[model samples]
Target: MDKQTILDVLNNLEVVDQQGGDEAWMLVDVTPEMIEELDHVGVEKETVLKYGDDESVCILALAFGEKYANFWHKGQLVNWPQEAVDLIEEMESALRS
Candidate 1:
């Protein structure tokens, strides 16, 4: 999938919950199907799994207001996974540019 196509999928994501302290920030439960789509778009399973627990994980996107995206395991961010950071940096640089 192309970048726009990937974004189209994100655009269609249903809001699962609001993030704490930021009323405009919301969580989207990234389903297995969604992960497949992301994988098709070049986000590897390893990258996705970096944020996952034994059960599942979230692909944290800004529900509304500001447009942002991040991955989180539980409510805290994990730094041990280099692939996750690389991906995040790529996306962040894209946004910055």
Candidate 2:
């Protein structure tokens, strides 16, 4: 989806910290500028996992230490599986509908 479409999807989401873990659900508000940044970086919204609430701008799962390095080495971020991204996108699509 395009930037505007992603923004619309994000606006309708709700942030929640499932399991009360360190994971945070951030529904980062996407501005035109933010969209430009993501586009510049070649990171698609569908590639990211949604975290917290609709009011949040972006959700991030963080892991610190050697494990983090290992995760990065494996092309994953904070243990976020590829399936999670797919799930988030599906939920976002449903929310929009």
Give the per-residue lDDT digits (tens) of candidate 1, residues 1-97.
3444555555565656655644334455657886787678666667655555434544443211112333443443333356876887798799999
Report residue 85 deviation for candidate 2 (angstroms): 22
- What RMSD does each model have against the real structure? 11.2, 14.7
Candidate 1 RMSD to the correct structure: 11.2
lDDT of 1: 0.52
Best by lDDT: 1
Give the Å error, residue 34, model 1: 1.5
lDDT of 2 by residue, 30-78 (tens): 4555546554544444444232222334433312221221122222233
Candidate 2, which segments miss by more than 4 Å at Cα? 1-23, 45-57, 61-97
Q: Each prediction's TM-score against the native?
A: 0.41, 0.29
The Cα local distance difference test for each model comes to: 0.52, 0.39
